[model samples]
Target: MTTLSLHWPAYRLFPYERLLAIAEAIALLSSRQIAEDPESVTVTADRPAAAPRLTYFSAYQTPRTPPAPTVQHLIESETSGGSRRQSTRYSVHGLHEYKGKFNPQTARALLNAAGLPKHALVLDPFCGSGTTLIECAHSGFRAVGTDINPLAITIANAKAQALRCDPELLVAEAEAAFRAAGRSRRGRLLADVRGAYLHRWFDAPMLARLETLRAHIVERDPSVSEILLVIVSNLLREFSLQEPDDLRIRRRKSPPSERDPYQAFLEDTRALAANVRVVQRHTGVCNATSVRAHQGDMRTFATAAAARGMISNFDAAITSPPYAMALPYIDTQRLSLVWLGLVDPGTLPSLQAELIGSREFNGSPRSIWERKLVDNSERLPAAHAALCQRLLEMLGEQDGFRRQAVPSLLYRYLAGMRDSFLSVRSLLRPGAPFFLIVGHNHTVLGGHRIDMDTPALLSTLGETAGFVTERREPLQTYQRYGLHQKNAICREELLTLRAV
Candidate 1:
């Protein structure tokens, strides 16, 4: 193999770059451990001392701290092949388990590679669960995140709030909430609430107790109450009849654990408070409260931003869009929705219809076909245009429900994604990088399964939206996590683009 020495944005390429079959004598180097001569001055008199450089998976970010791991070390870790296991119990990240959330390591790596100046602002258009926003804030960059899901916005906001508070104060607030929850008496407060699934999942007494706790928490100011409520929300799955691994609401023969739900809530609250302390020790506290998480549509973010008087000159962004026709995000988080009283059973169907990757048919089936044929064809790269045509052709041969709904699902997702790119382009400064970490979903058409290459397709569409396709790198976590899953996710891609 041939190796070439060069300098470029380091984080744009992933470990998968090494696997690419580039021409001989033109191999890409992934190393960031530059050789230094003691006599030669890398630091100059004119410039201030360089900021601390981060190493792979190293969370401690102080001057006296040990040096960071090299880019080679990170690549080795990613390529080492297995379930990419890293501790998620850091700082505010473990406050609540967000389904399909990408790891924090990946987010930090992307931010470092974006080559943004210090104190610059970053945007996450599809900031599911706020992983990117937390990373940006942790790295000392201002962050703004927008999501269509209010649950996600709440989770992100709560996590950010938790990260900012003093650990002792946070713990004290949690303890106070726990005490209030225990003291609150239950009655017919939720007697009129109607839901068959709630009854099936939770015993009436237990559900009543939970409702009492939720009422007490929600009655308080949302600042501390949200965190306490999230703690309760986290305990719901374990307390209920559902299995831990899968999102489906199947009844188990026995409880997953023998712990009492209230005790578990108290314990989790303390654990989360402790994680805040650890996070503070590793990454210094974000003094500026610059994180603004909006529960809004990505396609209409421009209007949302303008209304909020938000700045448009964003430097970089990192986000992972939901896979096409994949997980039912709103349905999966129903327990949280119900516990938080965000919606009742009646409102669920309408809320689920608003989700981007929903598989349910809520509108005309023909509109889906029309969208795929018309909207997707504009700004079509030759190859992508051919792929879209092929997918549409496959749609024509489909039978049953798949024939009626699949095209619409594909069109809805792609159109939202394309519009999201255009929205981000308007917010980003020219040449600012947009890093999208996305995985493809499998769609069956004509009784045959096909891998929808979402990264390449989105890159083509992004180019059409006037962005430069900078790089596409595979993520190891998807390979590891998707191993046992029955989905068509072969790998996740770090698809990078620069707003032109």
Candidate 2:
């Protein structure tokens, strides 16, 4: 057996004050308003849930599995040719509304082919929307990956610059679909009466626009499908008359002037092109071939990656798995999935992380918080009075919402974390290190405080899966200088573990 460990003790908590100050500075430089209200921010003076500043550790107790499990051979391999060259930071700034969260310029993602040891051909099975793959392609690694959500695969593929995609072609087809639909008629010819959920989520004109978008996607170049889909995915939420970003289909009034799918497509094309320009300027290189994003489930990734000609071996892997029961992404994303043809109802559920957010979310509503109340009541024992805290407190300062939705939301989040990480270990190379970015959240469960130290939990979980505890590096997300640390973004522990 081989074991190796390294620690970066210099990593420290962001001085909350400095972090906010820097955030303000960034905002100022970008000509945006910086809010001073703590409630408006994700950060706070509150101390994190009680835990050792990381005092305990777990070691792998299981005998190492054979260097390569026969089960690992299930993944099939295919070969493709594409070279990578890392470029400097790419940026065409001040282009979008959400870019405020972080400096979208620097590239922090790393892959096995770039500079790691044994692990090559990296897989971010949990490639939450594909931030990692985009980096790998530019860094010039032969990267392979998968996602259950088709739209995710499309975005990652587009961002990764998969040579297969051709956006201009897709935009061309979308225009034709709109013309064929006679979108200009604007009379009783449009009927938006089926699918209660769809009716509830989108108004008549909005649905018409979406259908136009869908038809174009169907007839357009499959290669740049992601480019068009990215626009569609964003439009599903964007064109909504709701908060322009709200998801509670039940609330929020419709928009005054609903989008025209043809129009939206044009807008998305511009956004994508500009987004790429920004990416190119900031990162300095454009390597789309290094990214191979497919729409599939994480549990089945070993086979999926293999089909792409990737061996079960990958170098270093970095990702953030959905915490348990946090976001029933499959369910939450159902509207977009169905509209975009990412999944059908029958098989869609399987794409979610199995352990977390499964239909088997078997816990009392307040079990997690009840536990926290018991543990933290001593700290602000008064909070134990069955008080209803804002969801933002639980989700990050920015996403806070009303009281009623907290329980189900928290339950789902935890499940996401558990099942998501378990899936990650299967694709990683033996003795290879995997790093994750995770944060602590507020809530009570089963009369137990539910805060999980990802590195600590993974150390325990990895050993069972035949890995050794390597190192855990924690950083305050609210740090002003590097990374997106907004809305009480809290801290993300960089967990490094080696497959044994």
User: lDDT of all the models against the reference?
Assistant: 0.66, 0.45
Q: Whole-model lDDT for model 1 versus the true structure? A: 0.66
Q: How accurate is candidate 2 locally (lDDT)?
A: 0.45
Task: Give lDDT tens digits, candidate 1, residues 134-161.
Answer: 8777778899999887788888888888
For each of the candidates, give the backbone clash count. 3, 60
Task: Give the distance in Å from residue 163's predicted Cα in candidate 1 to where it truly belongs.
Answer: 0.5
Least lDDT summed over 10 consecutive residues: which range in candidate 1? 21-30
Residue 115 error for model 2, in Å? 2.9
- Score every model by TM-score: 0.80, 0.59
